[model samples]
Target: MTYLYPQIIFSKLFGACLLASLMLLAPLTAQAEYGDVVLNNRAEQSGMRPVIFPHWFHRIRFKCKVCHTEVGFEMRAGANDILMADIIDGKLCGKCHNNKIAWGPQNCHLCHSGLPGLKTGIRGGDSTGGPGKW
Candidate 1:
């Protein structure tokens, strides 16, 4: 009976330790899996949800220089203060997101996809900055 008690206690402790480790790892995993940049500098005031820019999706078709260099986009978040007026003027994302090249900026909800149940379709948990596995 005494041996059984110690075994039971040890098993419970091991289970608790495993649970704690998993909980701590969850956030890191989520962050890596979804390397989405939430562009919300002017979204709320403009009466829209934040734009969730999924880097993985873009990287699949375009090189880094295409947008960061050719498009004059800053390498940091919120650095490009993009506005609807600028977009209509054929600037920033309008360079490609236009109806002729990609989807037009008129489809506002497509980029401003930060609603309550927005899903970015990103997967995996390795974020070493290499070609991210989706």
Candidate 2:
């Protein structure tokens, strides 16, 4: 009976450990969506530049419909028909960046600036001079 008691306890402990291991492994299989929206259709047509917009960080603060519906952004990138001139005239980004809601067009480095260290695969963060400081 003494030997049987030890074996039973060992089996219970092993089962518990196995369950915990499986639970920890489950999250590894979960899908993580990292934003990658391309901008600049003219660039694609002219073969000059390809703007990659990261939506994950923006989505954290703002809603999708704010830009999609209110700001007149289309579901897909390059479909919004956004122009730098329009923004300068208080259009899409200008709507919020008009010095009233968000940082105005005077701060051109905010959006016009692309993510640096692309070779290192480093995206948005405070370390990269992004809005992550706030």
- Best by the TM-score measure: 1
Model 2 lDDT tens row, 13-132: 999898778656544543323444545544345333444566886688789999888988767544567666787798997888789887776765455444332221223322322232
Q: Give lDDT tens digits, candidate 1, residues 38-69.
A: 67778777788778888888899899999999
Instruction: Write down the RMSD of all candidates, one decimal each.
Output: 8.5, 12.6
The deviation in Å at residue 60 for candidate 1 is 1.0
Q: How many steric overlaps are in each model, in order?
A: 0, 0
User: Each candidate's TM vs. the true structure?
Assistant: 0.65, 0.49
Query: In model 2, what is the error at residue 86, expressed in angstroms?
Result: 1.1
Q: Pick the candidate with the highest lDDT.
A: 1
